[model samples]
Target: MSKRKTDEVTGVETTGHSWDGIEELNNPLPRWWLWTLYLCIFWGILYTIAYPAWPMISGATQGVLGWSTRANVAAEITAHEAANAELVTQLVAADMPTLPQDADLNRYAIARGGAVFRANCSQCHGSGAAGAKGYPNLLDDDWLWGGDIDAIMTTVRHGIRNTLDDDARYSAMPAFGDMLEPAEIDAVVEHVVSLSSSDFDAALAEQGAVVFADNCASCHGEAGLGNREMGAPNLADAIWLYGGDRATLHTTVEQARFGVMPPWGPRLKEADIRAVSAYVHSLGGGE
Candidate 1:
């Protein structure tokens, strides 16, 4: 047996292990610290027994309480729906045209409608209702269909140029490229250009006026003022769906524009439809 050694500085006994001349202290941990560690292990075991702890083949261990976060969330949703039942009923029964007449109901409708617009209409019309190139701007006075509350409701319900609804707004502009000779088409283009501004060859515009009277005037008025009944856009105004430039105008005259809007009546509830219509009408450009 080797001789036992003591530390010179603290006078503690050696652990009987050494590297070179250095020795490890035989002093144990503090009693309070050891007890604290034991208490933590005990608490952890208790917690495991009381709560969801061990994983099983199919699921996790369910404690005696039978608590589930998913079930709690489902119950909360059911409760919330029950709370709004009355408002939903009123919204469904309310007259759409006269909806704005009732101040309280109108405010509630607009609030709900804003949510509806964000979810559905925002994809095309944008969140702020500022539409893109093909889409009509909701914030503008120009409307292909009527902009009144009744008209807006109808358009939203049935949609535009879509097969989903029989009463959907439909109009077809003939591809003049197929119908008119290249030179005739050119003359017509000049006339269409002159409708909004004086930036055109006067001789070509005069020739196009004759072509306009024969073909276009049947739907569009002689002055190019749009006929809302036929879903025709006013060519005289500066507002353009695709563009207003000569090149864009040439393309429009050569090939017609056909845009489709799917009917929302089958997908959205009546209340949601009316609410969104009200929201749009409230955007300050409604006639």
Candidate 2:
């Protein structure tokens, strides 16, 4: 319990408490360390005064810089737009056919179009335009309307199954549920399925033959070869729009499912529509 002097030069004292005969020093904190601690406190106070630091029930204080995350993002976008002025100009002026000549411009438009498509079309068409059961795959060559660049552009410019747009692509498939009885629809379904393969229920197809002639033959043709002028799909080709499954067939018969593709022309810039059309047309089935 004896006190001791540790530093003779400064006469620093040691704590009277000891363990194993080793005492604890009672030296003051180093001047440099104390100054650094004070500096941190001052910096914090200054930072609070200069920036939005205080928290209230409503919101934090508006910093002197008057900065916001949204403002920062807008500024960045503005800067980017300014930097790409020339490219944007080119995109606006260039036609779809000539776009491939300017690789940089084409690439920029494609990137922009891809972002737009992801935001808008990805929900139904899928991320890669693979499409859902009812939706037609853009990547495939099975187009209900047409797969040419001009055709795609026309489709995109005028949405299908949409009555809202005056120029919307409109076509009506006979609702077997309303037009014919369940038994008759079943017969037609069996007949339609049979077209894909050699196996077919002859009895059901015989019954369906009358129904097909009366209701379907007008657009689908007597042989079910399809009428391109009416955009009626070739039933014999095995490219089912809704699906080839029995359930999908039943649903199609029960209720005529109309797949609608939104027109991008009114919503998106011309350049973007052209780029997306080109990209979609290049997906292997483009005529």
Candidate 3:
């Protein structure tokens, strides 16, 4: 081994390893820093022994303490279920129409129904229930069926145009593509447009009036007002389901618009159906 040399100016010892022009100084590491490094190693060893740290071929090693995030979540969920058991039981058996009579139940139902609506109904009706082209707006007074609480509940439970459910609300607008000529269809479209507004050819509307009286009056009434009992929408109103534009009206008249709402009764709990109904009814449009 080579003997260590002292630097003249600084009086520091050389590390005895140097290049042709430079010598390295042998400096001692700070005590605090060395202690901190040792403490980190000790802590790492403790952590490995106390918690899950090692990985195996198939799974991780279980530490001394029996802790699992999945188990904790399950326990919390169980506790929450237990807490809501009584309310859920009451909601399950409660009369749908008289739900609001019990203030507490109604309040809880609305809150819970909001969550259920977001998860289930929001996809079609929208999160705010404003509705899209095919879907009916729940926030508006116009309803294909009645807008009463019981009516909403009935609709939610049985659904509309759901062929699978025996009690589903059913109706069909006959497709006039095969029955009517192009001129006759055009005349009828003009007549339907005139009933709502004068945004059509007067001569065509006059010709179409005869067609409307003969073909549409049976269900849509002589005055063009809708028949709720038959599920015929009020055409005279500004609000429309599939829209009342010329193109949309033509498509509706020719092909006939038949939208389907899946029955929630088969999918959700009884409590959930009631809850959603109540939530919808509270949206300022329920009669």
Candidate 4:
């Protein structure tokens, strides 16, 4: 048994751990710090016992409190839905064209519809309903189907060219790539370009006019004003869903476009669909 050495200068006990000429002092920890550490350990044990802390094979252990974050969130959502129930009913029942006549109901519908649009429609139409490259702008009067409130609602419900819904607005432009000769396609592209812009070859556009009258006039109308019933876009309008450039027109003539919109009728409630339609109608472009 080795006797613990003492530091002669301080009269304190030594741990007998030495490096070079220095020796380690056997000092006691501060009482306050030691008490704090003990309290922390006790608190941790209490927390584990009172709350969901342990993981079992099946699931996490539900503590005595029986509190759950998911349950709390679900409860909150239910409360909000209940609060808006009356308004939702009114919105669904209200005449869509004359909805704006009732200021309060219209306001509520627009606000609720805005939220719905942001969640579902914003991915394609944008947050401000400005639209992207391929997507048609909601803030424009150039609707391929129609821009009226009822028309907007109907479009939302059934969507465009979608196979899932039987009543989906279906329109198929013939992919002229296999049908038309390269020269004929080029001529048609020039004519289509001349409809919206002045920067087009006159001779080519003249040749294309014959081609347009023979093939495209049936759906696009004699003056390229488009048929809403057929969902054909007006070529005369500067607003283009794809693009108005020469190259874009060329591609459109050759391959054609088939823009598809998923039917919201199956996914969204009638009230929600109406609300979003109202919201879209209020975006300055609706007729």
Candidate 5:
């Protein structure tokens, strides 16, 4: 038979359960532990009273402090705006050409521009400014328009192929399908392809040169070198805007693909536009 033991300090009865000769004693919780638990409960009650707490029919209780998540966000935004006011003012006052000279202002502009580019320009001119086919790569030195700071600013302010902007870059490559015979376009394509390589057939080039001089030479130049003012691409360069294949050239001559980019000035803030233009200008071979 096992015997039960009572706790001498509390005069409480034993649990009457024993394990491995160790008997369980029914003792009161320690005063300190009990007080700590009570403190937690009291703190919870105080927190409920001081902060937004119980849900009602329509909404939760507005605590005594009247604090809200919205208020906290507004306060943070106000503080940030206050701090950036001087920088914003300086950026607005400065012109695009002079932005890069001011190191602090340029850094600020790039940061602002990066965000705007990610949101707007990243679809075509990727996040890193590496463009897809038909879209001009901002990273590369090859610009359809002039590559200067003022030129880039003008391009952004008035988008290319945007009919909405009356002053948009309006010149386009006319479809030679209606203008020239299929055989002639083919000969020109072959001649254009040959400009990049020494593999051109002299006889065919000689025959095509007459057709090119009459029709294409005005925009493409006498030697097939592109005209920037007319947005005509350089024929001799390895970097091709629309692929350098025979089929692609045929399609370009047949349909005459014109790509369009949106103007950022109307949608984005001036500082943000400046920053993005600077960032694009700083890309690989951007000068």
Candidate 6:
């Protein structure tokens, strides 16, 4: 090897590296920093050996400690479930109407039901249960079926207009686009609008009254009050499922609406269904 070059000014050795006239100093790293770096490398090796680190084709290498975050989480879940086992049992068998009489059961149901609602019902009914355009609001007294706790329970268990469950609440509005003239449909739309609003054509509504009585009154009632037995919504209320606007009303009248809610009875546990029902009933809308 060639003798190392020394800088005359600083009396320090130069590394083999150079650029233009600048040369690199062959200076040693600080003793503390070097020792710290070596300690970090040793600690990293220990960590890899003691805890999970390397990924394999099928899974990560299970370290010597054999500890798992997943296993810990599962254990915690099992413990919580064990604690709530009695309350869940009570919730399943308890009379729905008399649920509020038992404060502990009612509280547990609401808390558990809220979690179920957020995970399942929130996609359609909204996180706050205020409802979307086609979905019914749980916070209001207006219900297409009924607002009582029993009614709410039945609706939750069976659902509305779904084919999956045999006991599902079923109803179908006729597509009047195929049954009636366009002018006749428009007239009926105006009449329906007149039920909840003052901004409607008198002439159209008058003609539509006769049409409504013949076609819609059986399900909607003579005054458009709606028949809950038939799952018909109250038209007099400003709250609309699809909408009460003229355009929306016209589409609803012409094409008709067939909204479907999947049965929860098959998917959720009996206790869960009851809990969700109780939770819905407590939202100020249930009678």
What are the lDDT figures for the candidates, one per model? 0.87, 0.78, 0.88, 0.92, 0.82, 0.90
Clashing pairs in 1: none
Listed in order, each prediction's TM-score against the native is: 0.73, 0.71, 0.73, 0.82, 0.72, 0.82
Tell me which of candidates 1 and 4 scores higher on lDDT: 4
User: Which candidate would rank higher by lDDT, 5 or 6?
Assistant: 6
Task: Give the C-alpha miss distance for residue 80 in model 2, angstroms.
Answer: 3.0
Candidate 6 TM-score, true structure as reference:
0.82
Residue 4, candidate 5: alpha-carbon lDDT: 61
**Model 1 per-residue lDDT at 241:** 89
Global fold similarity of model 2 (TM-score)? 0.71
Taking every candidate in turn, the Cα RMSD to the unseen true structure, in Å, is 7.0, 7.0, 6.3, 4.1, 8.0, 3.5
Model 5, 217-236: lDDT tens digits are: 99989898889899888887
Please provide, for model 2 over 1-287, each residue's C-alpha lDDT reduced to its tens digit, 9 standing for 90 to 100: 45666755556687666889676778789999999999999999888877778998999987787767878899997898799888877876777666667888878877776776787778888999888777777887777778887778778888787865787777778677887888988888888777776787889888888878888889889988887667788888887767876678878877876777776668877766776776777556677
Give the top-scoring candidate (TM-score). 4
lDDT of 3: 0.88
In model 4, the clashing pairs are none
Q: Supply the TM-score for candidate 3.
A: 0.73
Q: Kindly list the per-residue Cα lDDT of model 3 for residues 1-287, writing each as its tens digit.
A: 67689988779999988899588889889999999999999999988888787999998877788667778999997897689889889988888778889999889999989989999999999999999999989998887789998899989999999887998888889888888887988999998998888678999988988988878888889878888788888888868898888888988888998899999999988878988999999999888
Candidates ranked, most accurate by lDDT first = 4, 6, 3, 1, 5, 2
Q: Is candidate 1 or candidate 6 better by lDDT?
A: 6
Q: For residues 14-113, what per-residue lDDT tens digits would candidate 4 score against the true structure?
A: 9878889788899899999999999999999888888888999998988788888889999997898899888888888999999999999999999989
20-99, model 1: which lDDT tens digit per residue?
Answer: 97898889899999999999999998888777889999999887677778889999968965887777688788877788
